[model samples]
Target chain A: MKAPCTVALDRTPLYDLHIASGAKMVPFAGYHMPVQFAAGVLKEHLHTRRQAGLFDVSHMGQLRLIGVNAAAALEALVPGDIQGLVPGAMRYTQFTGPSGGILDDLIVTKAQDHLYLVVNADRKAADLAHLRANLPRDIAVEPMEDRALIALQGPAAARVLERHAGGAAGLKFMSSAAMPVMGFACIVSRCGYTGEDGFEISVAGQDAPALAAALLDEAEVAPIGLGARDSLRLEAGLCLYGHDIDTTTSPVEAGLAWSIGKRRRAEGGFPGDAVIRRQIAQGVTRRRVGLRPDGRAPAREGTPIADKDGRNAGAVTSGGFAPTLGAPISMGYVRAELASIDTPLDLMVRGKAMAARVAAMPFTPARYHRG
Target chain B: MSETKFTEDHEWIRVDGDIATIGITDYAQEQLGDIVFVELPQTGDTIDQGGDVAIVESVKAASDIHAPVSGTVETVNDALVDEPGKANEDPEGDGWFFTVTLSDPAELDDLMDADTYKAFVAKL
Candidate 1:
């Protein structure tokens, strides 16, 4: 969630650790978070793909929906089949506005007694208000303000986490469990934003530093910062909250129709149900597609895109030099006709046209531990 | 005689005869993180002081390289096109962006020397 930096920023539980590790701190999502460590962004990104990287994601909001009717209440807001989520299973979904635009994307996990949610930091307050005003009165929305979230991601993440929590390595992807890590109670979810196989651990704020230090002590774990986190997720072809999917973009146009469960697709109870159903049936005028620029020059966010004939097509929402591919990669919305794979296009960078083309996403293949 | 000077934009210039070699300072490269691409000016291109001459791209963002003095581009470090990490490894030497034939040697007087540049960087 890349938001404008304001003067007053909060610090995460690991802020002192980041400073001690020589991290370059920057204001992010109302927090002074590390952008990169001494290893720099490139190395840190490559390392996470090969090994494991620990990220301080405490700035994100964690909340719980109590009462048995919570799942049904949330289903009224999103198109996902929240009621079908079995205990310990997680599902990725978005909060949609009445106009079919996405308010925010979040991960919801079904716990023993409540529905746990992890939402973007910048949108947390509004999300809370949305839940309180819309959800039924019996379903209580409790913010987990005392907790901190950290993600251990990459190929070696399972191994690093296994040393602390015995059962974590065995959990299947998109699953969660309450486990003890370094003797501290925590929620370990076998999932992450990076396309790599990993886990997100939620622990009490006070126990965060010790848990992070223990993970860093592992030979395979490196403390990754937000810079690598952004590039990694981009390479994974995942949509960032504000950049890729915002209030102006809908689930179908954003290429997120697959996230809408089959049951939810047939039943029309959620917000923007009619608009989403119409788009899903008739298709959207503009569709988000992955782009690969022909040259080494990076096409950043908001760069204008044109069709081969030089007509306006769309604008890049997220573009950067993918360290994994050694070339510039981007994701943007284009006219439905131009969204096909291999459709040639031009990216206007500084008034110069750079050759680009639509490509298949997950620019780097997703390596999820499905077992 | 060769003399080195620095600019507030974190660029360094080494004057040799009528040619001036330019590259970003180590601190600038550090601030930029890993340099992935360095767009160089073509030889014979004329530039004025403070003109946008090159573009240095890191994995996350791009930065403009402004000319510190007026000159005509002479030679560029073509190797940086494929191995831009050189800018991070040896920013002041092999990572030099381009060399230009100075239009006016007097422009050097307006730049900071090594000592002043170091002091200037310290305050930031």
Candidate 2:
């Protein structure tokens, strides 16, 4: 049967490889991405948790802010203390708007004389514009469009990486190093969105397909699609841009206050400093918490969360049937008083009130290797 | 024995003696992707024609399974409660949703026959 015609919204370096794998291509973030492969979504999700899964996240934006004033210039826009980011260390941070709402969450890695960053694929254009408009003239914001980002996540991810990239085994969680993989030099970071001990490889776009193929050749590595990626991240309590964290959610309300560096809070700089500092001091009214449904039914996004008296407490931002948990799990914003562990709650699913309870941030334990 | 008929919604029903076994077509299961959960009505519930009698949830979305003909539900496929993937694995056999006692077997004439269903699925 002829495959459906995929309009190339944008093509990654591994576009041909995805097509050969019988992937169902869908437009996402101005790029044609594989939503699912021939094995289907369920199998793909299961495979990733059991074994290593390679994901083509090339659609996400990669950039570098160069010059001596780069970190200082970046600190003006984000809540992170960029100046204190030691080289080879990565930090999860967010770009805040004027009113203290999050513009987008991004990973910032300090390289030699430059600040390497990765942002959400859908928010690339806006993020670039935000950087250009806010950054000082001395700092050069260079977009790394020639690079491709790939994630190898699962229990066997470290072993697969050690075999492909010689020095990858030495890297600890949230740390990165330049290593040679498949004869191509790339930056490998011991971090991932799946809450597993995984590595995200930033390689030249031209070398991405070969490296991806090499990783997939290993018995432990499988090609995961976006469908599984979403489910895995949801299970890990990681927020997705445009869904969980948006331009209206602040770091305090999103339960990401830890991302704000202690130095930044004490020094009191960055945009919306007054509002964010106040939230950190007094505590935010609403906080993001994990919810477990009492029944087998999944409480999907936008489901209304209710208190004991049936009053609207919050709304579900992300939810799905967690394959790992073997039950319905969800994450949503709830009143600060109701964000305690094991607090009883209810989810309004399809007009029917379903019993639920507020659990911890991650429904499953994160398996990232600290060492 | 009367001929089996199919609906555009992908439901199928075959009448043998006084009982009619109902299930979703293979094409329906394929379109729904991997079935993770199924909510079926109790065996004795009376369902009107075209009314929702069951729900099938896939990884991507959820859909309601409508009663193909007016009838009183006789027995449900209890196996589906444990293994919903049976719908994807065998939509026409072990994946049968429920059995119903037809209120009016004459209503079967309104459904499409096997050959017509074959052609109907071809268009999809």
Candidate 3:
């Protein structure tokens, strides 16, 4: 989630820790979050790919949905098959509007008695309101406001985490378990936004500082900030809530058909099931694809995407210099016909055309711990 | 002999006779974080003081690099094209954006000197 430009920015539980570490804090999702630590974005970005980078993601809305019908209640909102989610497993999904447009992408996990949801901080209020109004009164959507989330991500994430909680090393991707770390109780999940083998640990707000400190104490771990996080996710080909997917962008157009479960696809129960099914059967007009801009110049968001002949094709949704690739990369929607890999295009930046081509995402391969 | 001045827009200029070399302030580069690309005005282009002339892109956002004084573009630092991070490494040195033949040397009178720029940055 991106920060709002308001003066009343809130602080995370680890605010003092951030200040002590010489982190450069900026307003993010109504909070004064760190955009970069002393290591800087470039080093932080590279460190996450090569080793472990710790991230503070406490601003997101962590909610617990309870009652016997919680799964069915959530299934009515998203296209994913929530009922099929086994305990300790996580599924990536997004909330859809009536027209099949995305509201916000989130992760859903099922536990012993409730469904765990992690939504964007900016849309938490509306999401809660939507749930309260739509779900049966018996079902409860309780916000976990007292918790702080910390992510330890990268190739060395498992080893770093294992130093504290030995069992964490055994958790596979999209799996979760309650672990006790340094006398603190926390829920650790084998998932992260950076497309790395990592874990997102949710613990009490007061325990965050110590937990974060312990993780950073690892030889391979560094405290990364939002700047590197954005670049990392972009290189991972993940969708950012407000930028990549929004109220007007459908899941199909956003290239998220895999998120829509087969059971839910055949049985239309979700909000935008009809439109989503239609787009799935007959491809959408536009598709989200990775772009490789030729030359050293970087093309940013809103740059016009044009064909070789300078005909308007689409617009860039996200673009930046990938520290891992050492080149400019972008992702945006283009005409489905032109979304094929290797399709030559140009990013019209500053009234001048920069050479670009549609390439296969993720710019880098996803190294999730599926085992 | 040359005089260096700074604009409220966070740009620094070194004036030697009618020629002025322009770049963003060290504070400006620090605030913008790591710069990835720089778009400079072509040589021979006439620009007004405070006119938008170049673009410096970081991983987080793109910031406008404005012309601090009225002048015609003489030459751009082509090296910034390949190594934009120089703006963060040596913002006032090798990161210099372009040189211009000042169309109005009188504009320099209103710009802040080194000490004044330092004080102004302290307040920001």
Q: Rank the candidates by DockQ, best first.
A: 1, 3, 2
Sorting all predicted structures by lDDT, with the top scorer first, yields 1, 3, 2
Give the Å shift of residue A248 in candidate 3.
1.1
Off by over 4 Å in 3: A1-7
- Give i-RMS (Å) per prediction: 4.7, 3.9, 4.3
Q: What are the Cα lDDT values of the candidates?
A: 0.94, 0.89, 0.91
User: Interface RMSD of candidate 2?
Assistant: 3.9
Assess the local accuracy of residue A318 in candidate 2 as a C-alpha lDDT between 0 and 100: 86
In model 2, residue pairs whose N, Cα or C atoms come closer than 3 Å (at least 3 residues apart or on different chains), thus clashing, are: none
Q: Mark the 10 consecutive residues where model 2 chain A has the least summed lDDT.
A: A1-10
Docking class of 3: medium
Name the best candidate (by TM-score).
1
What digit string (tens of lDDT, one per residue) describes model 3 on residues A24-53?
888878899999998789999999999999
Alpha-carbon deviation at A33 in model 2, angstroms: 1.2
Tens digits of per-residue lDDT for model 1, A1-371: 23555479899899899999899999888899999999989899999999999999999999999988899999999999899999999999999999999999999999999999999999999999999999999999999999999999999999989999999999999999999998999999999989999999999999999999999999999999999999999999999999999999999999999999889999979999999999999999999999999998888899999998899999999999899998889999999999999999999998999999999999999999998
- Preferred candidate (DockQ higher): 2 or 3: 3
**What is the lDDT for A290 in model 3?**
96
